[model samples]
Each structure stands twice: as structure tokens, then as C-alpha cells.
Target: MKFFIRTFGCQMNLNESEIMAGLLINDGFEWTENPDEADIIIINSCSVREKAENKMYGAIGGYGKLKEKNKNLIIGIGGCSAEKERDALLDRFKKIDFVFGTRNVIDISNLVKRAMKGERFADFSDKLNEVNYSIPKRPFSKHHAWITIIYGCNKYCTYCIVPYTRGFEKSRPIDDIINEVEEYNKNGFKEITFLGQNVDSYGKDFGDKKPKLDLLIQKSAQFDSIKRIWFMTSYPSDITDSLIDTIAKEKKAAKYIHLPVQSGSNRILKSMNRRYTKEQFIDLVYKIQKEIPEVTISSDIITGFPSETEKDFEETVDLIKKCRFERINIAEYSPREGTVAHKYFEDNVPKHIKNKRLQYIMNLQKKINLEENEKYLGKTLSIIQEGKAGKNNTYMGRTINNKLIIFQSQEKLNGSFLKVKVNKVSPGPLYGEIIEIINNI
Candidate 1:
């Protein structure tokens, strides 16, 4: 049998899809890139943004048409959006044969078995039945892999749906995570990222001897084969001194921090239940910069929240100018069902206004990106080789601080690390000349 999986949303969703692919491959199924040629079609979707949700529905409809030509084709929906809709998803998407929630990824093989037998199934239970770490996976990058250090989120930010869809914080055992990293290293993978919804709160759910994130980084650094360690999406209030210290002191750990500050206005932040104030967030960014002046700080920002006024929008703009973030992911707020903000707060912000605010923030960030990239002109940057960027021998890679650089080079450096001298700077990517290979990936 052949299966094809289309993934949407965050890195966690991508990871989950990869796991699903692994399970299918182990069940003696081959993967097909084209849905029309596959026996099964799976959509791993996200519901954080209304745009993503609409995409899911549109994809289902398109796949339904494809199913008409192939009578035996089985269609499945999984992840946040599927979990949110639950059993109702089957009713809404009449062509779908099965639905699996985020927590149901462990039983995917069994679900597929039942699905193949013509038994319709919808598993929305909130059980965290995780598969073993040794499962075969089709990793996105041969040299880099993601280790889910923890699962789910506890902070029920009013505007967020991850807490309800993915459930509460469930930290994986440190030994298990370590073993996974070690295995990746042994398999010739040079980079390993520790991932969690809130990585800073990794060991908090467990007993007193809860292993610290710093310890995990330190132990992973001791691995002989691995060259890079990265992590992401730290809650502002959960970041600790030790975490900053580890990143600053450890050579293997990348010097990039992804701490999201949803909004800049204190009133709007409170409305979103973000827990930290704008002043506190600024202070935290300052602290991170103080510890590691060369750190590349990235952030997530949402515009046009419920009751967001022009003054609140101006505050966000002012905050961006003050902090000068290296990179910013801006999103226009859309009320999701079952979230506190959805239930209590009115979606009073006009769509046009929301779009205008989003564009304003993104435009500002583009200038910042250009200015920031300009600073690296004539400086040497260490970059890992990503695949080809375009035709004419154009290749791409990212610096340690997470800046993508496109350069002209004849050498094939797919997974290798090389130092490049920055020649030109633009808003989109850095142009550089390869100098020498640092580590052959």
C-alpha cells in the first residue's frame, strides 16, 4: 500500500507527521508524493489561524474529488484541527474515513489497520500514549533532527487553542530524550533540536528531581558526534538564568532565542492572558542580550486582538522600534472556538484594520531585517549547507543565528558547515562567498 501525508502548521505538527510516516513505513507501506497515486491520503493540519483551518477544509474537498476516481482511497485527518473538531469532523467532512487527534499518533498503525478493514474510526481521547524513541522516521533534514523534549502546553493563553488541542504540559523523560539524541548522533546527524511547546517548562510537571533544560544541553554537548543543539518557543515567564547561562556558555548550543511576546500593550496582553507585561518582556530581552550580546533574538507578535485600539497598535510599533528584534513573526488575530478570548471577548477589530496593522508590523520588521543583515557585511558567518536556492549554482544555508544566506559556490555542501564572507545584504537573504568548510556534514 502507498500513503501520502500533507502537513500544515508549526514544527511540532511537522514532527508528528514525520512520526506518522514512520509508523506507516514500518507497517510495510510505501510513501507516495502524489495523493492520486496513494492508497491513503493523510492531512496533518493546524487550527491556530483561521487561514490554516480554511486550507484544511479546502484540501479535504479537493481530496474528496480525487477519491471519486480511486474508490479504494482512504482519507484521514489528524492534528490540532482534527482534534478540535473531534467526531464532528467525520460529519463535516463526509469523504474522510478516519480522524486521529494529536495524542492518538501512537496508535496510528492500529488506526490505519482498522481503517483499511472498512471500519470508520475517530479517536479523540486525551491519552499521551507516545511511541518509543527508536521508531524509524523520515527526517526533514539528514543532518538535523528534532527531539521532542516535551509534549503539550499548560499556559492557556486566552487567544490560543494549543492548550486545549494538544493538552497540558507533559515532559518526556530526560533519559529518553538523551538516548534519542545519542542515536541521532550515532547515525551521523550533526544537529539536534530540543523541541517543546514551552521548552523552559520542560521538567516542571515531574517530581522534585525534575531534570533541568541546561543539564540536557550540557549532556547533549558531551556527545562526540553532534555539532549543534537548538531549542525554541520559550515562555517569557518560564525562562530562567540557568537557561540563558547555558546558551551563552555552551559552544554547541545555538545563540538564538525564540521567546514570543504576543502583544506590546499591557492591556491587550492581560486580555490574552500572556502572564508577562510589556515592561517585563522588554526586561527579559535586555537580560538575554546582556548575557549574550551576540544572540539573535526572534519573537512572535499578534496584531488586532480583541478590543485592540489604535493606541495599542502604536504601542506595539513603538515596542518594536525600541527592541529592534532580529526577526519577528507577525500574525493577525482570529478568534478560535473554545478559547477564553473567543468565548468572552468580542472580535471587535475590523478585518481591514487587522490587515493594516499586520502589514505595518511586517513592514517595520522588514526594515529591521535589512538593517540587521547589513551589520554582517564583510564579516565571516558560519553557515550549514541547505539545498539549492535557485538555478545558476545558487545554494542556501543558514548562519548560527538563523539568518539564511544565498551564495554562488561550485562545491556541494549539502549538510556541511562552511564559513562565508558576506558580500551583499538585502531584506530577504544574505549574499556571501564561501571561504572554507568548517565541519563536513
Candidate 2:
């Protein structure tokens, strides 16, 4: 049997899809990129944004038409959106055979077996204890892999749906994470990212305020095979001095921080239930920059949030100018059902207004990104070969600070680290030529 998986959302969702594919592959099933030839199809979903939810629904409808031609085709939905609307989804779409939650990925093989036998299933139960620490996975990348250091979120930002869908914070033990890193290392993977919704709050669920992510980074750095360690989607307030110091001191830790500050207006932030104030967030960014001078800071910004005023929108613009983030993921706010904002606050921002705000922020950041990338010109930087760039003999790799550079190389350098001399820079990506390949760091 052939199975096809289409993933949507963040990195965690992508990793979950790999786990599902691994389970199916181990069950005597083949993986296929073309859904038309597959016996089973699964959509790993995201519900953080209404746009993502709509895409998943549209995909289901389009794929559902395939059942008319292929009577034996089995369709499955999993991840945040599926978990969020488990009951409604099955009732809404007859093509869906099985629906599994974020924590229910371990039972994928069993679920597929039952699904093949014509038994419909929806398993959204919390399976924190039942998860296999060393579960089988078919990683998407050969050289870089994501090890989920923590699962779910406790922050429950008013505009977010991750907490309700994925459930509360449940962190894996340090030993288990290290073991996963070792597995990736054995597979010749040079870059390993510690992934989570709120990575900075990794160990708080274990009943300790200690930053276990820092400790995990420290342990993962000990592996000589791993060249870079990275973590992401940090909660601003949870970032500790220890975490900053650990990133600075560890040779393998990637000099990039993805701390999201959703909105800049204090009043709007408060309305959105973000714990930290704008002033505090600014202070934290400055501190991270001061401690790790080479670090490239990235952030997420949401415009036209509920009850946002022209002043609030300006405040966000002002924050962008002040921070000058290497990159800022800008989004127009859409009220998601079951979130605090949806339940209590009104989605009062006009759509046109949201679009205007989003565009302004995007243009501002594009200018800022170009300014930042210009600094790399005429400089030699270290980069690990990620994959082919699809342009002639050029290949793409990321710098230690997470800058993607395209450079020409004749050799197949998927996992090898190399030095590149930057010859061109733009707002999008840096162009360079490989100076020398580093066999070992």
C-alpha cells in the first residue's frame, strides 16, 4: 500500500507527519509524494491561523473528489485543526476515515490498520505518558533534523489556539531528548534543532523553573558530529540570563533566537493576554543582543488585533523600527474560535485596515532585512550545506545566525560544513562562492 502525507503548519507539525510516515513505512506500506497513486492519504494540519484551517478544509474537499475514481482511497486528518474539530470534522466530511490528535501519533500504525478495515476513529486523548521516547521517524532532511524538546503550550496567548488544541505543556525528559540527538548524530545529521511551542518554558512542567532547554543545548553540544544546535518559538518572558549565557558559551548553538512578540501596544498586548509588557520585551531583545553580539534576532508580529487603534498600529510600527529584526513574520489578525480573543473580545479591526497595517510592516521589515544582509557582504562566513538551490550549480546553506546563502559548488555537499565568501547580498537571500570546504570542525 502507498501512503501520501501533506503537512501544513509549523515545524512540529512537519515532524509529526514524519513520525506518521515512519509508522506506516514500518507497517509494510510505501510512501508516495503523489496522492493520486496512494492507497491512503493524511493531512497534518494547523489551526493557529484561520487561513491555515481554510486551506486544510479546501484540500479535503478537493481530495474527496478522488474517492469517486478510486473507491479504496482512505483519507485521514491529524494535528491541531483535526484535534480542535474532531467531532465536527467527521460529521462535516464523510471522506475522512480517521482523525488523530497531536499526542496520538504513536498509534498511527494501529489507526491505519483499523482505518483499512473500514473502522472510523477519532483519538484526541492526551497520550503524554504513552509516547515512545525513541519512536521511529523518517526525517525530512538528511543533514538537519528537529528533536521536539517539548510539546504543547501553556502560555495560551489570546490570539493563539495551540494551547487548547495541543493541550498544556508536556516536556520530554532530558535523557530522551539527548538519545534522540544521538540517533540523529549517528545518521550523519550535522544540524539538530530543539523544537517546541515555547522552548524557553521547557522544564517548567517538570516542576522546576530551571531552564532545561539550556541544559539540553549544553548536552547536545557535546556530540562532535552535530555542528549546530537551534531552538525556536520562545516565550519572551521565559527567556533567562542562563539561556542567553548558554547560547553564547556553547560553540554549536546557533546564533539565532526566535522570540515572538505578537503585538507592540501595551493595551493591545494586555487585551491579547501576553504576559510581558512592550518595555520588558524590548529590554529582553537588547539583553540577548548584548550577550550574543553575533546573533540574528527574528520575531512574529500580528497587526489589526482586536480593539487595536491607529495609535496601537503605530506602536507596532515603532517597535519594528526600534528592534530592526533580521526577519519579522507579519500576519493580519484573524479571530480563531475557542481562543480568548474570540470568546471575549470582538474582532473589531476592519479587513482593509488589517491589510494596510500588514503591508506597511512587511515593507518596513524588507528594508530592515536588506540593511542587515548588507553587513555580510565582503565577509567570510561558515555555513553547512543544506541542499541544491535549483539555480544552475548553486547550492543553499544557512549561516550560524540562520542566514540562507546560495553559493556555487560542484560537489554534492548535503551535510558538509564549508566557508563561503559573500559576493552578493539582497533582502531575500545572500549569494556567495564556496571558498573552502571544512571536512571537520
RMSD of each: 1.6, 1.3
- Residues 1-441, candidate 1: write the lDDT tens digits: 999999999888888888889888988999889888999999999999889999999999999998889988899999999989989989887889999998878677788888899988798765464555777787878888887778889889999999988888888888888888888988988888888889878998788834388889999999878988889778999888988899899988888889899889999999888898999999989898889858888889998899999999898898898888888888889889999999999999999999999999888999988998899999998888878899999999987778889998654678888899999999879999999887544
**Angstrom error at residue 106, model 2:** 0.9
Best by TM-score: 2
Score residue 233 of candidate 2 by CA lDDT.
80
lDDT of 2: 0.88
lDDT of 2 by residue, 1-441 (tens): 999999999999888888888888888899999999988999999998989999999999988988998989999999999989987899999988999889888788888888999998787766667655578788888888987878888887888899988888888888888888898888778898888999888988787567688889999988878989999889998998999999999889999999889888999899888999999999998888889968989999998898899999888888888888988888898889988888888888899999999999888889998999999999988998888888778889898899999988865687788899999999989999989999878
Top-lDDT structure, candidate number: 2
Q: In model 2, which residue pairs have backbone atoms overlapping below 3 Å?
A: none
Provide the lDDT at 97 for model 2. 91
Residue 24 in model 1: lDDT: 88
